[model samples]
Target: MKAVRTVAMLALCVLNADVPLNAADAAAVFPDGAKLELLWSDGEFTEGVASSPQGDIYFSDIAGKTPGRILKFDPKTKTTTVHCADSKKSNGLTFDLQGRLIACCGAAGGIQSVCEVLDSGELKPLVSEFEGKRLNAPNDLDIHPRGWIYFSDPRYGGPEPIEIDHLSVYRFDPRTGDVVRVTRDITKPNGVALSPDASTLYVAETDNGFPEVPGAGSGGGKVHMTLNAFPVDRHGNLGERRILKDFGKETGVDGLTVDSEGRIFAAVRAESRFGIGVYDSTGRELAFLKTPEVPTNCGFGRGDDGSTLYITAGKSLYRIPTESRGWFLTGQTVP
Candidate 1:
C-alpha cells in the first residue's frame, strides 16, 4: 500500500477561482487543468467511496477502535488491496441493483448496522434495530431505484450508549424486511443521495457540535449546517423539507454524489472552504474542487472510470477528472 502522487497544486490553484461560474459553467465543471490525485495515503480516517461494477475503488478505513477497513482501489492495477479486513466499523459504500455490497456499519462497539457486504467477507445484518433500539451510527448510504436503502443515523463521537432517541433518516426495506423512519427533520444526518430520477432525497445536515450522546446531552445548541431536499414519493415516503444548502456557521456536507445532470457532489467541510462542492439540483454553485485534506467522501467511477472523481480525503484516496458523470443505481442510463 504505497501509491501517492501529490500534485493537487492547491487543487489546481482553486480552479473556477471563486466559484460564481461562467467560463462556460467553469469549463463544464472542471476540465482544463484538473489535477487532485493522491490515491492512497494509508488511512485511519478515509470515509466511504463506492464505484465498482468492474471499475474498482471502494473506500472506508475508519480504524478508530481497530475494526475498520475496506480498501480496494485498482483503476487497472495502480494497486491497493485489502477489501474488507473486518470492516464492522464501515461507513457507507454502495452498490446495489444486485451487485451487492451495501454497507454503513457505523462504529462504536461496531456492527451498528445497515450492512450487507457478504460474498463471504461477512457482515450481512441489513437493518440493525429500529424499534428494538440499537442504531444511531449508520453514517451514509443511498440506493433506491426501488430496492430502497437510504441510511444515515448520525452519532459522530461514540463511546457507546445512544440507543436512538432521535437523529434519523432511514429506510431499509430490502423487499419487506422493513425498517422505515425516513427523516425526523434532520439535525445531524451526514451524507446521503438519490436523485437522478429517483426523485430527490439529498440530506447532509452534518452538525459538528458533536455531543449527542457521550455523557448524554449538549449537541443541542447551534445545530444545522444544512443541505437538505427531501421529496421522494412512490412509496419510499418523505416530503416537506427543502433547504438545499445553507452552511451558515461553516463545515457542512460530509458526503453526497449525484451528477448525471442532477448535479451535486459535495464533501465541503469548510475550514475556510476545504474542497469539493459542485452543487446544482437547485443548490447552485456549480464547481469547486479543492481537497488537499478535509474531505470525507465522494465517488464516481465505473465503466471507463465514468468521469473519474473519487475522493475521501485526509488519510487519503483522492482522484479528479470530472466533466461530470455519476448517478448510479448500477450501470448508467437512469433518465
Candidate 2:
C-alpha cells in the first residue's frame, strides 16, 4: 500500500509539471517578474475589460451562447462578482467622465446604443438608433477628454446585410443623448481607442469573413488588417482619415486601448499566437505580449502605485505591471 501511494504521488507531480501556465502566471514575467495569478477563472471566456474609479476591473463574459454577463473584479480581495447578467451580449466597455459604466451591446440590429446604470440600478439608454437608421452593433468604445463618447459599430457578427451598406463609427453626446456618425469607411471596425491628447482616434479594421490561407492559416485566408487614424472635433465630428498600420497577413485585430503616452495595445489572434500588438505613437509595432488565450480587450489602470496592464482573454482576466501610468485619469484635466 505504501508503494502504491508513492507511485500515485509521483504521477500527480508529473501531471502538474505538464500543465500549462495561465494568464496570471504569464503576467508575473513583467518587470518585477510578477506573473498574473488567476483571480477567478471558472472556464468562462471573459472579454473586454474596464476599470472603475475605485480600481475594480469589469469584464464581459462572451463565451456562452445565451446568458452572457458583465462581471466586476476587485483587486484588493481578488474576488469576482456578477455585475449585470442578461446583458445584450455586451462586448466592449468603458466609463465616461461621470464614472458611468458605458457598454457596447450587440445583436440589437444596426442600432448601436449606450447605457448607463443609474444609482438606482436602472439602465438608461442614451443613444439607441442613429440617423433614423439602425446602427450596425457597437463593437468597442472610448471616451474623450471633452466628455464626448466615441464607439465603433461594425456589423461583422450577424449575417451580412442583404440591403444596407454596413458598419460605421459613432460619437454620442452624453449631455443631450444625441448620436452622430463620424466615419463609415472601414470594412470591419473591431477595436477603437483615442490618443492621449484626444486628437487622434484609432480604429482597427479586421477581416472576419475570408478564405483560409493554406500553410499560413492564422484563422482565415488573408487578414486585410489595418489601423486608421482620424482627426476629431470637440463636438465629436471626425475628419481626415489616414492609414496608421497595416498587417496584411489576416491576424485580425480585435479589441484595443491606448496608454497615457499614446501607445496602442491591440489584441490580435495571429496563427494561434494570441497576444497583444504594441504600437508606438508613430504607429510602429514595438513589442508583443504573447498569451495562452485569445485576448479580446485590454486597458491601463493603477495598481501597486504605478500603472498596470489589465488584459481580458479567453475565460480569464490578467494584469501585469507597467512602467507608465494609468490611461484613465481623474480631475487633472486633459485636452
Candidate 3:
C-alpha cells in the first residue's frame, strides 16, 4: 500500500512538472475558448492597446498609483519592453495619420491634456485647456485619418480632485489646433474609438458616480452607468449623441475599438460574462469574445495576409485570428 501511494505521488509530480506554467489560467476572470495565445503578461493592469504600422502593440500600465508607463509588445519576437515611463498618467494611446503617437495625459493641473511623441521620443503638449478651463481627465483617445482626434475627458484621473462638473468628449484638430467639446452628458466617459470611415465615434460610459466603488474606492463609488455613440463631423465637431447601450451594476464598458467592418469591440468590466463585448454596426450585441482576463482594451494587429485581434486584460495580452481584418493598413482614406 505504501509503495503504491509513493508511486502515485511520483506520477503526480511528474505530470505537474511536465505541464507548462500558464499565467492565463491564473489571471483569467472568466471562461475563454478563443484559443488564447499569451503575448505578454505583467503584474500591472494594462489598458489602451494600439498597433503601429509595423504591427507592434503599445499599451499603458495603470497599476502604480503615482507612476504609470507605456509598454510595447513585439509580435514577431514575442517580447515586451517598457517603451516609456513617466507618461504623466497617460491612459489611452493611438497613432495619427502621420504615424505620430497621441496620448491622453493627466496630472494635477494638466488634466485632459493632449500630447504627441516626437521621433526622438519626446512628449510635447498639444491641448491642455478647452474654453480656458482645465479639461477633465482625458482617458482614452482615437484618431481619424483626416487629422482629427477625438478624446474622452472623464474624471477618472484629474486635478482639483473634484467630480461635480459633467464629463465630456472633446475633439482636437491637428491642422488648426482647435479644440471643441463634442458631448457633455456622459458621466465617466472612457475609451474612445472611431469607425473605419471616421463617421461615427464610440465612447464608453463608465459613470461610476464619483469617489468610486464605495469601500472599493476611497470616496469614489456610485458608477452612473451607460455607453454612448456620437456622430463625427469634418470640422472636428460632433453632431448628435445617441445611446448605444446600458450596463449592469457590476459591469461597465471601457476602451473601445472598431473593425474594418465597423463593428465595435468594447472591454467589459467586472460583472461582464465575457471579457470583450462585440457589437454590430447598428449598436447590437453580435457576440462576446471571452478573453483570458478582464480585458481593458483591444487592437487589430496586421499579419502577413490577414490581421490578428489583440486584447489587454489585467496583466496579460491575448490574441486570436479574425475573419475580417482591420483597415488601419489598407490605405483606406478615412474622414
Among these predictions, the greatest lDDT belongs to 1
* Ranking, TM-score, top scorer first: 3, 2, 1
Better of 2 and 3 by lDDT: 3
- Whole-model lDDT per candidate: 0.80, 0.67, 0.68
Per residue, candidate 1 scores C-alpha lDDT tens digits across 1-335 of: 44433423334544535556756775797788777777678788988899878788888888877888787888776677777788888988988888888889875768788888876677778788898989878989888878878888888776777876777888887878888888877668889898888878999888877665443232856657989898898888999999977888888889988878888888889888788888788787766777778988898997778998888988888887878888777443332
Model 1: lDDT of residue 255: 90
| Candidate achieving higher TM-score, 1 or 3 | 3
Relative to the true structure, candidate 2 reaches a TM of 0.80
Could you give the C-alpha RMSD of every candidate to the true structure, in order shown?
A: 17.9, 8.7, 10.0
Candidate 3 residue runs with Cα over 4 Å from true position? 1-33, 108-112, 157-164, 212-222, 270-272, 303-306, 329-335
Please provide, for model 3 over 96-166, each residue's C-alpha lDDT reduced to its tens digit, 9 standing for 90 to 100: 87777788876544434788866555578889877777766678888777767788876654445443255
Q: Count backbone overlaps in model 1.
A: 0
List where candidate 1 sits over 4 angstroms from the true fold.
1-23, 32-47, 50-69, 74-76, 92-104, 107-110, 113-135, 140-162, 168-188, 192-242, 245-254, 257-264, 267-277, 280-282, 287-308, 311-335
The TM-score, computed over Cα atoms with residue i paired to residue i, of candidate 1 is 0.33
